[model samples]
Target: MRSKAAVRARCLSYTGCVGILVLSCFLISSCGNRRIVDHIKLIQSAGYDLDGKRVRSTILIGDYTEKEKTNIKILSTESVSSMDTMQRQNTKSNQSLHTGQMRLVLFGKQFAKQGIGSVLDRLFHDQFISSRLRLAVSGTNAAGLLSSTVNTHDTLFIMNMVEQNEEWGNLPKLNLQTSLYNYYGAGRDLFLPYLILEGGTVKIDGIALFKDDKFATNVDIRDAFVLKLLTENSRNGSILMPLKESDALPDDYILMRSIASKRTIQLVSQEPAPVILIKIKMKVSVREKPEYIRFETKEDISALERKLAAYLVKKAEDFISLCKSKQVDPIGLGDFMRSKSRGWNEKDFQASYPSLKAKIRIDLKIVQSSLSQ
Candidate 1:
């Protein structure tokens, strides 16, 4: 038999060996569990297109290891859903597809018009997908637009285009969070930036208005700009109001710069139908004008401001008329009424919606003249 000291030492050695074995096993298990980012394909942008019973999904994956590379690998597949497409794509690809880097998700026009309830639900349920991803509606097929060689890589290209516009362009800041709210919230709807392929280039065509999840109609960028001004507290955009070409004028238009704008929507009365009043105050400057107009004279300035006010009132009325005709409210009129009135619900709002009358008042403040036409 061994001495007591020797026996103790032997027991310690055995315990040490066991500990080392356990540590090694734990490390190997952890290594297998964690995903290696470098090995996986990072999806930067993706588009969803629907063709009857099938869904066509296209994604842009860039080689992260490659520096300054423009061309990206495009992976596309047709399946029942976006998640199904991903599973199928993974089978075809050696690298696992990752969506942590996805910034934009676009829907083809047809897909949008068909309604995106089920698709959006799937996306919301996806644990790996970011809900903050920007949304847009493509005037053309989303897959075709993503596959086009307009830019070496359309992911970064499209992201930059949309981001820059949100900053300086005439668009309200809209993302997945706001979109979800609009969709689920009563008396509200979602509007996404509209994109189209123009002359071998992708361009912002207009705004796609959605009544619930289904596409209602599209307003070109010009009208959308005005809509934003009316809804948002302050915005920047330019509108060229045509001054009829006459013998005295060298140019036939007055380019008005939108320095700032303020709008107030009031629920005036519920008599007969909901009577709403919209008050718009605009601060503008003359960016360009016909040579015939005199900027130095106060009378002339007042006349120009009046002209702007009158034009805007008519424009606003026309916009509201269009909304009524389409039976779609992109202006959030329902929400406004709901907030102000008691006992207002979907049924009540629907009854009053058809005969909803609106009065628009516009006050234009001309600030400065950029140049003498």
Candidate 2:
């Protein structure tokens, strides 16, 4: 009894209602894939070690059954590849192992030495893994260091150790994203925090130097500070300078803590290879100094600043020498040159890198003489 136009309108209305219902259904189904915390095991930290022909992976997961606190559970498995290690670990775990919350990944020294290109590649491709995830090199083997953290809240302890050092201590900032860029990108090599288990407690020992993807050597924390100064803008990094006999002072050493630092690199020449000049300008607080030194007068402050500047320039040069000897480019000098030069080739750079001439100039100012006061 309805008119033709009215019937057509009614049919369109029904179709529109059906479309809305279908969309709602689709959305609900998509969200149904949401996982509950209780049903999935979230991996907070993972470590990889090469065991002869296979790779061993150690994972730490938090058990949240306790009302007041979360306890850690350690799970380890050995397999041929990183993906297989995960699959094997899942077989052992009660719930599915998820790396969505992973905060740290460590490679054993031996494993890192052999090469970590494949592992780094896998981490880069993983959708759930965060770019901020911290990476490091273990002192010996990852399993040993991880086992030492059984009772303690190992995950947060190690994560905070590396993060605190990078922010306030001597370490330079390095994470998953930076490591990937340095490894995959040309003209630079990657470095990572070197962690060693000392006296049954985990401690950050130094910075692990790398050539391409392989671990080349380790530099102590002091040298690491020099590297940090040259590579990036730094703050709150402290170092000790042992005075030479020629410099007459009551004390034998000066402890300089960086308040802020800036580094500038310039390509001076390129015809006979590259001649690079690095200028490091720093504002530092003298935490420890000779008692005989006086900071009350402008002349006294200026003299002390000159001595500190000379010391830092010498240290920076020594660091550059070591890197050149090792054939490593952690400072990305090559990368800088590549940007400036018209036809910079990696092969040509490597051939001429060992004897590359670099000049370091330091402009250090003593903003605070706490020891003098």
Candidate 3:
């Protein structure tokens, strides 16, 4: 019963409603796209340093399209805190500085030696910074660590090397997230593996140990290898063990495809010069039998085990000696003491740790022999 004019009017109103609805949806989606800022260069590596009153942050910008290319941009601002510096950076940068993809956070040797607790507290509090990002101590300035280049087999090269090492477990991977956990956790000392660029390759020179907030000392590769075996459960790796005169090897021996490890700690006396008992268990497979020894008996295996036990005991003692000399509780001896004996003050606990006597016992059991004559 509707007339042509009325029907036309109704049709027009329906069409208008449909158009309005479509426009609303388009507006919402367009707003989403508007918020997304492109051309923001991704930062792969970052270095931080303290300059008088403010902190200087250096970021490495990489061209994703051309994997071979990289550029270093320095962002400096005088602010009361790290967050303030970041806010200032946002105003100057054309592209938003996103830290979701950050891989390496390098601390200058000077800053590390002094103390990193304050700086690290700020880093861990950031919402954008990943907890799992790799952390390293630079032998030189942090800026040098970010800017230095290493040429290697791959096209992407150095960046690829870092990624591969982290993924394959060939090297110790310590990140900001793991560092914070170890730092705050009681009875656990934190350690970061140091990286130094040398002869076109990045080498894991040693480990940097921390006592409270300061750098304790640099443990060499030999000590680090043993530490790795002791702390971690996985033991599939290679190491070079010194050959003794009575052993079968010529001058020195190299162990390949071997796994070594052991860990045991005990609380001895409570008063009158408190003592702690530490036990270590290790097992190594013979990869290459040295020319100095002729073997084919059970006695050989037992003798090798004994030799390995003695070697481990000596190494453990050496490490303990080094720790004692530094007056650094890198082994979490303080934590063990606190756990065993409650109602202990931090100040008094630290004071007592210097003279704490540690008795270490090492036991080596030969599990398998890979050498075939």
Candidate 4:
């Protein structure tokens, strides 16, 4: 038989084991959350430019905690690669560089043309970095993009502009994670916002389409809206589209506020000639109308809807043809084909992609007029 003292000792040992396990877990969790925020140099936004075999990186660090004051600093360096450039940038920075607060990462046109796989691969592997980080291609010098005068020290000014546009304006939904998904995922390519410096101010130039990981070309911001409608799930945006003279409206210009758009793509055939049927149902508002066109009748409104649908059909068809010619599947037509077919190969898909027939049908309506929602 065990003595009473032996039982107490065993109970104390079990309690000690439980306490040790609880303490270990607390230490592990505390280590995971450990951060010296004040000591870390949080890069707010950064840009990459390629010069020959070298890379130029520009980082923006901003502190705007003080009332009506912002401390802004711009650091740039050229190196063999983006990771190396970051290493060099750390030396130039007053504090240890960290990407915990990164909002935007811009790649210059030349850098994008060369390829962004290495830089992006490194960033993607960095588990500490944000998956929702915005990525853009700069039409101007990447380093020069942030050299302009700014009102706020927080890099939020430039980043907020793009974010707000994607949220409420014409830009599509895109970020580091989505871009990478399209890049690595089969049957679909990637698209990113293109930024250009205009008169010392940065503006969203268009949408940059990628043939794999390399930059292909750009779709104009206006056309980007159409692409967004066709490819993405978005419900709000405005397009100041120009309508030529029609039986209903003799004017050549009109404003369209997009309310909703739904697209249906079907791959009907794979042999002889590949054929895909596309249909888009879109609702828009007439924000501007010319006095030259008298809209006194319901028939007139119907005519306007038909005219707008026709115009959009022509534009969207042209855009799709352009993407086909460039060998880019930004709309994931190949993905749609894969979903429909039993077995598909990349070689067959590539060979048959450009020749694929795209038949479009647009059902459009003017839902609102004169800011009446």
Best by TM-score: 2
> Tens digit of lDDT per residue, candidate 1, span 195-305?
999987788887898887898888887776777776777667777776763553447778887788888988788777889999988898887766667777899889999
Candidate 4 lDDT, tens digit per residue, 31-66?
Answer: 754568877778888989988888999988876567
* Candidate 3, 1-373: lDDT as tens digits: 9899999999999999999999999888877434343567556677666555556666665544545654345554446544565567677777777776677777666667767787678778868677767777766566655555422222223345544554443344456776787788665677777667676446667777877667778887667655655555435444556765566445467353335555777888978776988776666666765676545688976877677666766776787778767766556777778888878666787677667788877666656665455
By lDDT, the best candidate is 2
Backbone clashes in model 1 = 0
- Show pairs that collide, candidate 4: none
Q: In candidate 1, where is summed lDDT lowest over 10 consecutive residues?
A: 242-251
Off by over 4 Å in 3: 1-37, 49-56, 67-93, 150-173, 245-250, 254-262, 367-371
Model 1: residues with Cα > 4 Å off, grouped in runs: 1-32, 245-250, 369-373
TM-scores, all candidates, are 0.85, 0.90, 0.76, 0.88
lDDT of 4: 0.83
With candidate 2 superimposed using the best TM-score fit, by how many Å does residue 240's alpha carbon deviate from the native?
1.1
- Backbone clash count, each prediction separately: 0, 0, 3, 0
Error of 1 at 348 (Å): 2.1
Would you list the rank order by lDDT, best first? 2, 4, 1, 3
